[model samples]
Target chain A: MRSFIKLASVALAGLFSAQSWALNIFACEPEWGSLAKELAPEATIYSATTAYQDPHYIEARPSLVAKARKADMLVCTGAEMEVGWLPVLLRQAGNPRIQADQPGHLMAAEQVERLEVLQKVTRSMGDVHAGGNPHVHLDPHRLLQIAEVLRDRLMVVDAENSHHYRQRFVDFAARWALAIEQWEQQAAPLKGLQYVAYHKNFSYFAEWLGLQRLATLEPKPGVPPSAKHVQKLHNLLEGQSVLAVLTTAAQPTKNAERLARKLNSPAVVLPFSPGAEGAEDLYSLFQISIDRLLAAR
Target chain B: MKNISVWMAASAAVAFSSVADAQNRGRISSTEFNPAISLILDAGLAIYDNDEDYEIAGFPLGGEAGVAEEGFAINEIELVGSADVDDKFYGKITLGIHQDEGETELDIEEAFFQTTALPHGFTVKGGKFFSELGYLNVHHKHAWDFADAPLVYRALLGRQFNDTGLQARWIAPTETFLEVGAEWARGDAFPTGGSPQDGRGSAVLFAHIGGDIGASNSWQLGVSHLQADDVVTELGGHSHGGGDAPDNEFLGDVTISGVDFVYKWAPNGNAKQRNLKIQAEYFVREMDGEFEFEDAANAESGDGNIVADQTGWYVQAVYQFVPRWRVGLRYDQLDSDNQFSNVSFTGFGSADDLIEESGWADEDVKPARSTIMFDYSNSEFSRLRLQYSTEDSRHPGEEKDQQIFLQYVYSLGSHGAHRF
Candidate 1:
C-alpha cells in the first residue's frame, strides 16, 4: 500500500509538470509576439498592442493586466518604447516572475546596439528616447541578435524545453538568413533613394537599404506636423529628386498625402510592424515594406 | 619602481578605453537613479455674470469645493514625485499649491506606497491616497476632461474623497476584466469629519468590471459603497451670540453609495487622431443623526432628531473630432429630502429657521447646471481650453449665472503614464 501511494504522488507531480511545460508569453507589441512565436511555436502568446496601434502610448487595460498576471515570460522592445503603460501594467500585474532583472523578463532592444542615441536629452527634444531609437526590429541584423538573446532567455526560464527551443532557433536562424540575403539583393535598387517620411519611424529601415531621408513631416519626434513645418520641409526639398513620401499604417495618411501632393510623388503606406496589411509575419513585414518602396519608385 | 610604472600605464589604458566606450554608447554623464519629478501648472481666467456667494441649495460645501475665482488666477500648481522604493514597493507623493482669498495655500494631496510583488493578483497600498470610490475620483484634476469637478462630486463627495488610508485590491482571473477593492481610512476630511469610531472613521468597498468591445471600443462599470460612523458637522455653531440664536451641531452616521460607467471609442484602437469618451456617475447619501442646539443668550438648550437623504448625478461626453482638438458637454443635477422630529424650542428661533440654516431642508427645487467646453493641445505636455457654463444651482430659480473660462495647463519634467 505504501508503494502504491508513492506511485500515485509521482503521477500527480508529472501531471502538474506537464501542464507547466507550455509557456505563456505576454508581448508588449505584435512584433515581439511574432518573434516569440517563431522561437517557441508551442507557447501561447498574447500581444498587448496590435500593428495598427502605436506602441509608445497604450491604455493599461484590465485584460492586459490579467494576461500579465498569468504570463510565464514577458517580451518587449524596451528602451522606453513602452514606458507609458508597461510600468503601470507590471505594477498592477503583481507577478514577480516577469519583473525587471528576472530571467523571464526579456527586453529585446537592450540586447542590440541602438542607433540615434542622444548625447543630451530634455523635454525640448520632443519625446526622444534617451536609450536611442526603439525601432531596432527594422534592421534584420539587429533583429537576429535580439533573437539570439531571446532564445537564451527562453532556455534559461524553461530549461526542460531547452533542446526544443535550440532546435527551433537553429532552423529559424537559417531560414531568416536566407531570406535576408534575398531581400538585400531585391532592395539593392533602393540604395541612395531619396525619400520623405511622416515620422522618424523608418530610420533603421532607411539605414539598412542605404536610403537617403531628405526630411520628415513632423518637425520633431512625437510632435504632430503643423502647416508651417510642412511648408518648410517642402521648401527644403522642392528642387531635389525625391523618391516618395512614406508613412506607416498606424500613422495618419492625410499629412503624408498632402506632402506627397506638394512634392508630386506617390505616397507609400508601409506595413511598419507585423499584423498590418500584407505583413502577417516578420518575413512578410520586411517583404511588404520593400515591395511598397520599390512600387513607389 | 619599473613594475609599478608598467601597472599604472596598463590601468590608465583600461580607464581611457572605457571612457571612450561610454561616449560611443552615448551614456549620459549625469544619469542617476533618481525619482522622477514633474510639476504641473494650471492657470485660468474666468468671468461670471452673477458673482454672489456660490452655494448649492441643499448641500453644505466642505474640503476644496468652491467656484473658480473671477478674472485671472492661479488655479493649481502641483509637484509630483514617484519612484520604486525598492524591489518590493513603489512610492509617490503629490503636493498641491494654489491661491485662495489672496493667500497661497499648500496641501499634501497624496502620499502613498503600494506593494509590487504580492502574489495571487493582490496588491496592498498604505498611506494617504484618493479613495477609489467612483470612476472619476481616482484621477487627478489635470487628467479630468473638464476644467472643474462635476456638480455631483462637489455636492456629495466634497469635490473628492481623499484621506489617510490603507487599501487592498484583487483582480480576478477572468477572460474579461474584474477588480475588487476595499479601503479603511482615518476619515479626517470633509463628508466625514472628526475621525470618529476610535479613529477608524470610514470603510469602503468597490468593484469594477470592464472589457473591450471589439477593436475600437472599451467600457467599464463600477459600484462602490462607503460607510462612516460618528460624522460631526457644525451647522450654525459660532462663538459670537445673538438674541434668539442657537449654536447647533450635528452628529450622525453617514452612508454613501455610487455607481459609475464609462465608455470609450477610438478608430481601430488608435486614439492619436480621434476618440470619444462618455462617462456618468450617480450617488446617493443618507445621514441619520441628531441636532444639538444651545441658546446661550436665552439660557436654553434643546435637541432634535433629523434624517436626510440626498442624491446627485452628472453625465458628460468628450469627443476628439480631430487630432489635438476636443469638444465636451456635461449636465448635472441634485436633489435632497430632510425630515425633522421631536424638536421643542423656546426663544431660539423657529425650527424652520434651524433646518434652513443646516442646508438640509428640501426646497422642492432640483439644482442643475449645463456646461460646454472646447480644448486644444499642442502636444501631450500643454493644453489650452475655453469653457462656458450656465448654472442655476446656487440660487435655484433666482437667476442663472452665465460663466466663461479660459484655462491653460502645462507640465514640466518627467510625467507618469495616465491610467485608463
Candidate 2:
C-alpha cells in the first residue's frame, strides 16, 4: 500500500511539473484583477468588485466564502475603503495564505500615493476616511507602480514561475506606457478647462486630464445642497468661468439641474470608474467619461 | 426627436469646450453619444398582525380590505425610474400600486428631478423624497436585509414610510466628512385621505452632521422637530371609539408633536479588525384630545393630557478572521407607552364624539418590543440571518411575546464607489 501511494504521488507531481502553477489570486477590486491577469495568465482569478457598483457596499454571499477559503493570494483596496465588507470576508475565508501579516495578504492603498488624507477623523462625520481616497487606480502614473507591487508578491508565491511573471509584467508595462501617451495626446485638447462636479470622487481624473475643478456642488460634506446654496453657486458663477457641470454614476439630480440651468451650463457624467458605467474595459472607461465631459460642455 | 436635438446640442457644447487645438475645434460636431435609462421595480406582501383600521397609518390598511391574511397584508408595488439628463442631473418618478382582498389601490410615490452639483463640494438635491432614516428604508424590498421592517420603526413612525423632502449634502474638500440640511414635507402623510380631510398638516425641519472618525470608521448625528396641528377623523356614522365609532364609539382630535435625535457609528481599521456599528434614537410626544368611554360609569376628561417617551437603538459587531467568512450579531429594542389617560366627551346617548368621551377598554395597557439578529455574511452580496424579536401590544399583559426569524439576501448589481 505504501509503494502504491508513493507511485501515485510521483505521477501527480510529474503531471504538474510542466505547467508549474504559481498562484491563484482573489482581488476585491477590478484593477488588481487586471494586473493579475497580466502577470499570470494561467492562474485562477476572481474579482469581487465590478466596474459598475460602488466598491464600498458589496454584499457577502456563500460562494464568495468558498472562493476565499481557497485563495492563495488576496488583494484589496484597504485604507478603510473596503472595510465595509473585506474584513468579514477575510475572517470567513479562514485561509492562512492571505491573513494579515501573511505574504499573500495585501491592501493596495498602502502600495501607492494616497490623496485626501485627513488629519483627524471622527464617527460624527458621515463616512470620513483617514488614509486618503482609495480610488488611486485612476492615475496612470501610479498604475505602473501598482503592477510592479503586484509582481513582487506574485513572484514570492510561485518562485519557479518568477521569470514568466517578470516577462509578462514587462510586456504589460510597455503597452500601458504606449496607451498613456495616446491618452495624453487625445486629451490635450480639453486640458485646462474648468468644470463643476457634484461629488469630489473625480478629482484624480480631473488632475490627470488637466481639467480645472472650479467648484463643487455640495454645500456641506454628506449634506444635500439646499436651494439657497444652489443660488449662491449661481452668484459665484457670475465671476467664475466654467464650461459645464460634472457628476458621477449615482449622483441625485435635483441640485445639478438647478446649477446647470442657472449658469447656462450643460451637465455631463464622466465615467467615475475604470469601466463600471459600461465602456467595456478600463481604457474605455476613461475614454467614455472624457467624451461625455467634453460633449456636455 | 427631442432627445436627438438635446444630444446634438450637447455635442455642440463639447466641441466648443475642447476647441483649444482640435482640427474640429469649435466645429459643433464630433461627439459620440449614448443616452440610457434604468428602472427598478419593488413590490412585496407582508404577513404580520396589525390593526390599521380606525387609525391614520393602520386604518387604511385594515379597514379597506379587512386584512388579506388574518392581519397579513400586501402593502405596495412601487416602480421607480431614473433617466440621466446630463452629467449631474437625472429625472426621477415613482409609481405605486396597493392591494387588499376588497380593493386594489394606485398612487404616485415620488416624481421629481435630482441633481448632484453645488458651488463648494456640495451635492444639492431637491425632489419629492422619502426620508433616509434607516438602511432598509433607503432600499426597497429586494434589497432589504429582511422581509419586514423592524417593530420599532412601525411603532414610532406610525407607518414605516416617509416621503416628500429636500436636502443638500456637502462632502468637505478633505473628503472625510459630510453635512446635510433637510426640510420636511409641506403636505403629505401615510393613509393619505383620497379626499381633502379637514385639518391643518405639519412640517419638519432637520439638521444632520456626520463623518468617519477613523481610517475605516463612519457615523452621523441628526436632530429634528415637527409642528403638527391636529389629526381629526370626521365620523360618517354614529360611532363611539377612536373616531366616534358607529353608534358613538370613537375618540377625537389627537394633536401630534414630537422632538427627536438620531445617532450612528461604526469603528474600523487594519490591525485588530473589530467591525462595530451602533445607532440610537429617542422621541418625546404629547397627544392632547378627547375620548369616549366604553363603560357608562367612566366619564371623559379634557386633561387626557398624554405625555410619553420612546427610544430605539441597535448595536452590531463583526470580526473578519480571513477573507470570505464573517459572523455578526445585532441587538435592537423599542420601549414605549401605548395607553394615554382616558378622554371625557359630553352629551351622552353616544353619537359621534359624544360616545367617545367615555374611555378605556377592558384591559390596562403598556407595550414594549425588541429584536436581535445574528448574521453570517459569505461575500459582498449575500448572507444568511437568524433573527429573534419580541413585542408587547395594547393589552401589554399577555399580548407581549417573542418570535424567531430567518432570512437570506442575494443581490446582483455592478460595483459601487467606496467613500460616499
Interface RMSD of each: 10.9, 22.3
**Which pairs clash inside model 1?**
none
Off by over 4 Å in 1: A1-20, B1-33, B233-249, B292-303, B344-348, B395-397
lDDT of 1 by residue, B1-420 (tens): 113343345325532343344345444311344688889999999999976666677775666777788899999999999988888888999999999768999999999999987877789999989998899999999889988899889877878889898999998877787889999998776678778877788999999888888878989999999999888754433211223435656689889999999999999889888999999999998878887766555465566887878999999999999889999999999988867799766544777655555455567768899999999998788999999999877534567888898999999887778878
DockQ scores for all the models shown? Answer: 0.29, 0.02
Q: In order, what lDDT does every prediction score? A: 0.82, 0.51
TM per prediction: 0.90, 0.44
Tens digit per residue, CA lDDT, model 2, A1-297? 999999999988877863576466888876677667778878777776555445665534334444565577887867667766665565434455666544466666666667666666543444446666667777777667767767766666565566787899999899889888988887787788888877566667777889887777876334446688888888888656677787655455568877988787787765565444666555676667766766765
What are the per-residue Cα lDDT tens digits for candidate 2 across B1-420?
113343345334432222222222111110111222223333323234443232211111111212123233444555555444554554566666676455777766566655532234344445665554443333444444433454444444433445455655433332222333444443344322111233224444454445434334445555554444444322222121234333222223222322222222222222122344344444443333433233233343232433334444444444444333344444545444434555344434434233223222213233344555555544434556655555453332333344455555543222121111
Predicted candidate 1 versus true structure: per-residue lDDT over A30-100, tens digit per residue: 88999999999878899988888888868887678878888888999887888888988988887777877
What is the overall TM-score of model 2 with all chains considered together?
0.44
lDDT of model 2 at position A82: 70
